[model samples]
Target: MPLAQRVHNLPSYLFAGLEAKATELKQRGVDLIDLGIADPDLPPVDIVKQSLIRHLDDPDAHQYPSSVGDLAVRKAVAGWMQARFGVAIDPAMEICITSGSKEGLANLSRAYAEPGTVVAATDPGYPVYANAGAILNGAGFRALPLTPDNQFMPDLTLAEGARLLYLNYPNNPTGAVADESFYREVAAFADAHPETLVIMDAAYCELSFLPPKPPSLLQFSKNVIEFHSLSKMMNVTGYRIGFAAGQPEAIAALVKIKTQLDSGAPVFIQRAMAEALAAYDGVNPPADAQESHNEYGRRKALLEKGLKDVPGVKQVYPSPATFFVWASVDDDVAFVEHAMEKGVILTPGRGFGEAGEGFIRAAVTTSADRIELALQRLRDE
Candidate 1:
């Protein structure tokens, strides 16, 4: 039977052949050192795990959750926003609990993008922004190039008049970050174009290794809807707990669209996320959150050091935040193939977007010993 047209419209899977190759290698008795995907190797901190377990027995936790999320959970998220960014958010009017930022991102265009409306995003950005935000909805897309000259930040002017603008910071693939001045520029642009709505995907905001955590775009402009995820921060990816906060109109519209979709994120998971979010010590999170950064830092350092002398690697892009290290290669596709042959798995940059063509992204999700081993294999040590 033929599938829906939308299924066919999806972009090619980034790891299409890599999975099969992995299986073949495994069957042939090759042990692979994977630095492929950027999933956290750490566990959710004690606070989150305890919270989840503490609430598991409550009968209310087992019931159908509020489609827009429970009021208590929303209030917790609002409180976190206030504590972390000093930004006031109305739990009722501005915040909507989501299964994950993925759900909100997928539904954002559905709620706001009328057919043929333009959706703008950074090139070499997360694919969801292009697939869910534009293609599936039949909205026109404009790619704002993120070349090194621009420090991987899209010029706000390039996104002018777009119906919806998607921004990710401590960005995926490249790991570039935006500071206050850029956000101020974004705010000014938003003020000028009241018709365009900016969506900030702040999934990696708290994972920075440098001092002074990344600032929220909300602190600069009320014109943005920010998606916060507990996946990377709290190591709760499987829980799928995230929230969206912004203008009431946008939140309401998203909630309306969500009503027809999944029921809601589980009440217990929401409760657990709420408790964990409260553990933040104002702008800076405590030890639990910092643990991932430190460990990933070690692994990333190994990759940086090992790849430094590799003949094929042109430049190892400095990633101040996220767990992935992006490096320009002579031939991205060939680099990944060569790494696989050396028993190390990596993701080719072209998988992210056209602009990522000559690069490869290596994740630090594995243990330090494994990372070292991968490096040694690459170096023929």
Candidate 2:
């Protein structure tokens, strides 16, 4: 049997190795406190559940949904975008409800990238950006390394000639947030290169701890396509619902590709998502919003304080958004292995990219007490 040539080019998945190690440890009876994967421990909001219940009995939900998504769901997304970012989107032309942001992103690459085209991404960033490009046999997958000096922002000079540039603010592993000025700079950069399209991964947009939530790239320029996920916002990772908004042409291209990949997301799930989005006010959300934000804040502080006291551990990038703390250490892989031995699991920065070699990412997805315990174990190690 032979595998696809593209599979040969793909690097080993970062989290799969960590997950396998965790399973091995659990089978051996190790009491492991996993801080590696970013899946929130919180349950989906009540509205999401209630909506699904109401829709599940409808026979319409059992059939294949429109590839572009349910009209009501698309309208709800547009409404949310308008209220949250002050950008008006045409539900029929500018939005595509995806199974999840991850699937949307992968398909976006397929829509735009080709053998002679370049896709630029942050080196110590999401692996999907680079991997998606590779799957298309892209001419070049350029990695703009994020470093301390650049405030973890990818230098645009390196991305010259690239057709797609992937950016994640309130970033995944680093948890770094981008401000208005940075977005304006990116807008100007996009203006200079009209041919390039920016893919802004705003998965963590709703998880900001600071005032003035992260701004949408749509608020800055039309050259950008932004991916939004319900996984982080509504604690609905299992639902696999999200949307891609921006550039009408891009949305159409993605919808065309998705039409062949899978029937749009399940109709019941789409109905549930629609209900959740309609009720959400990003500026003044439901009361439960503060609970998760405050809890993550407390967990982040606890982990940061503990890491500060430990020898050889440095809090290199303290984030104002997201539930992740990126720290610098002597050797990320060794630290990850040692932490696993001590019954604590963390993600190595090197797993993100070469630029992440000296760092480690700890996710605040568990309760504060468990985070404290994980911190204590790491410190004692």
Candidate 3:
């Protein structure tokens, strides 16, 4: 069997080792609370489900979909951006839907990373961003470290030769949210560095716990590119519906790159997505879903409480949005194993980046019961 040489040097996911250990425990009949991934347990909206079924029968749906998503879905996305973020998006020129935000980020790297380029992303950030850089021998781009002390936002001064700056607010793992002041600073940073491109990973924007909405890059800088996903907010991860909006140049570059990689999403999926957004007005989230957030909040409180006693864990900050709790921990490998052996599965900080080595990302994707259960196990261990 042969594989691409470029992929041979890539490292296995940092969280995989712990997850494998968790799998081993589960094989032995241990109900290991799997909290490593931020995959939501809820189902997508009913309209989305029905739409998929109805479209499944269409012969056109069987063929390859267009490279650019259908007009309806694009319009829906533009509508969402305008209604939610107060930014007007030209569905055709300003927005392009991707299979998922992860793919959007990966290909986005290819679009921006010319030779001798640097890409800035938060430390303890999502792994795909770093992997994107490694693929092209640093030609893809490098991530700048964003630490807990800085409230998980990168200091513009620390970023050097950064052609692309990738950011996620209501961030993954850390669950941090940025205010208008933070965004204003980012805009100012981009203004000072006109040559640089700011890629905003707003995947979790819709899942925010804050009011007045999360600050958007579009609000501040014309050079900024933004990515949004239906995965977390709508519990439609498997559906692979995500989109990006930004300057026409950046958006056009990404769309061109994406076209070469694969065909676009099915028309029915686009229709369904549009329907989901329309139905969003009257949609009532299930109790379990509502409870999911509350439960995570409770677990966050409990974890923070427990952290006070844990030696080597420091710089604990309260998470205001998203479904993750980031904590600085020494010996992530050992800690993850110990917790998993006691029936808990946590993502090691190193999985995100080298800067994440001293930390762990605790996802609230699981139920509060599981969170409580995992915390108890950690406390006992």
The segments of candidate 3 whose C-alpha lies over 4 angstroms from its true place after superposition are: 1-5, 57-60, 137-141, 282-315
Candidate 2 clash total?
Answer: 0
Candidate 2 or 3, higher lDDT?
2
For each candidate in the order shown, give its overall lDDT on alpha carbons: 0.86, 0.85, 0.73
Tens digits of per-residue lDDT for model 1, 180-281: 888888878877888899999999888888866788888888878899999888877888989999878889989999998878899999999998888888
Task: Pick the winner on TM-score between candidates 1 and 3.
Answer: 1
TM-score of each: 0.97, 0.96, 0.90
- Whole-structure CA lDDT of model 3: 0.73
Better of 2 and 3 by TM-score: 2
Error of 3 at 90 (Å): 0.9
Candidate 1, superposed: residue stretches over 4 Å from native: none
Over 1-381, each residue of candidate 3 has an lDDT whose tens digit, in order, gives 898765775777655666667777888899888777788875665667877788778676667776667777889888777666678888888888888888888887787675567767787787776667435534554556767667777777766567777788878767788889888888888778877887789987766553655767887776678988877766778998888887888888887987999798767777767766655442233343445455556666766666555555665667667877778777887777777777878878888877778787777777667777777777774
